[model samples]
Target: MTAACLMSTYQPLALSFNKGLGTRLWDQDGREYLDAVAGVAVTNVGHSHPKIVAAISEQAGLLLHTSNLYSIDWQRQLAQKLTRLAGMDRAFFNNSGAEANETALKIARLHGWKKGIEQPLVVVMENAFHGRTLGTLSASDGPAVRLGFNKLPGDFVKVPFGDLNALEHVRKAHGSRIVAVLMEPIQGESGVQLAPSGYLKAVRDLCKRWGWLLMLDEIQTGIGRTGQWFAFQHEGIVPDVMTLAKGLGNGIPIGACLARGKAADLFTPGSHGSTFGGNPLACRVACTVLEIIEEQHLRENAREQGERLLTRLRMELADDPNVLAIRGQGLMIGIELKQPIRDLTMIAAREHGLLINVTRGQTIRLLPPLTIDEREVEMIVRGITRILKTA
Candidate 1:
């Protein structure tokens, strides 16, 4: 009930919510707030969705978990669905995005080792975020992620994101040592930075020519958040390895590492495993989440609402001097300010009764639930516009 018991990792806002519905949250005092952050994009179908709640309640009553030693029917069904949607051949389950990315890194190392290459290196992008674990942290960029943790694995080669020439330089310099190139399709944590047009396709082609596995960390851009089953589909390209989490279970906490071609078969029986991964409850909930997204046509809604939000924000803030850029895809939108506004998130919550987030200091990142309607989108645009104009 108090912050004293928890670790000092996160400095959460002073407010706390007692309940949540589709795109809305209520505090202990019964004050309502529009949730644009969506639990940092984990609640794509919206908070406490009926179907998701039903699935969770039913699965809890039936079975919660069984370790990876046994065969899980739900896991098999979920895996089949996800791989089919992703165009990947196989999947390995984990508990979080960090674990999923760690699995991909391991697969890349194994792929290199099989070909008799020693000290395999994975090419990563600068300002890209994978996860907080040591291996994933090494693969990620930015000093905040790498600070305090000394002696990180030095096998990752960091290059500027969206720069093909830099990638080429890495290939030329570390061609033999490099086993894979890992990056986010859209850099989410350091603000919603999208890949340059045609960049993903070019990276896929380069990987094909250089014989390096192309790994995409789609933790934030996957599921129905990007108006597609996965962000890679937007570019019409497929990577050898892909990592997913955040929205897969719609807040149930499940992560997956999907692979195709040679990358699929690299993980042998004992090579990698998780105790709680792919359990019945998580898998069943994920299956329901996927079904809800498909049945309700949430992806289409995401695109439409996203475009509506983007256009309205641009129109409203077009003449504002403080606003620099407005960019987004689907429900993942960002409004970059000319300078960081201190305590912007707190002001949005306390004064405007809206939930939001700021990343890379200057970008107001919005990851509203995919289930939001027109009225909610309008509310978001209005709240954001007011905050920016006053700031």
Candidate 2:
């Protein structure tokens, strides 16, 4: 717990959970709390689901890692399953969201390289948070995340998320020099900023016109988290490349960048890889996660519960002067306050036994597990109502 023992990288709460199941978590003292955060959307199927636990345990005993030199059966099965779900032709596995994004960015660069472009730029949105690596951080936008990481890698151009005019301007100016458009369907780290309706389709059309690959960062929105296999599916557009992680492995550290069309064949043998990603253990757990999501109908569950939650919150907080707006799709919800509520998460957890996060200064971000039910949604609404009353 002291700085001498471990690096001070995270500002985590003092409370530690010893066990968790579904939407409930028990701290070290056996204090049960309604977990609305769900490890920031990592445990979409909820913590310690029996199927995932069994798969991890079985795979651990059978095999863990065999390097990228040999063929992996579980990895292949997972790639097939993910590509089918994602509507992408091929998948490249990596260790985290950052790595997945890194892979996709590289593919975009290579795509431009095939045409003999010297430096290709990818159009990213302002306030977008792709990842924390040097490559992803370059694609990402946010003052706080980029404060100390100066002179970061840059082949990325920025436009306001959902701003069609700005995007059009970028396309007009950059033209073929822009190789791709990489952005999140719903911006997660800078708060849950959903792209406007029909916005994605517009981007898809523009990408087609400019001959740029459209890469969607689905790290926080994929794996049935946003009530769909992929959030972009809601707009009826398939991205050329899609990066996935977080809920894909349900707390296991694994990620993938799926590609279609010419982008799919960009990476040949020895082009890209990860030492521990998509190993036997992680792939087995991911396959099990997919099976559980489908068998349990978690996607439909998320849509239903999310609508109920959003409706109830809007109704309950309608007249509150401090409430700015309530917005989201499926389980990815956000409550924007009129003033900064940075400490709201701490207060909710400490006093109300509910976990939440504050992002973009005043927005209360809630990403509960997709497996949550109507009853649990009711608890979440009640908890928020009680907490905001104090605010």
The best candidate in terms of TM-score: 1
TM-scores for candidates 1 onward, in order: 0.98, 0.98
Cα error, candidate 2, residue 318 (Å) = 0.7
Task: For model 2, name the residue pairs that clash.
Answer: none
Compose the digit string of candidate 2's lDDT tens values, residues 260-368. Answer: 9999999888888889988998899999999999999999998999999999999999988889899999999999888885568878888889998888788888999
Model 1 regions more than 4 Å off = none
Among all windows of 10 consecutive residues in model 2, the one with the lowest summed lDDT is 1-10
- Count backbone clashes in candidate 2: 0
Segments of candidate 2 deviating more than 4 angstroms: 1-3
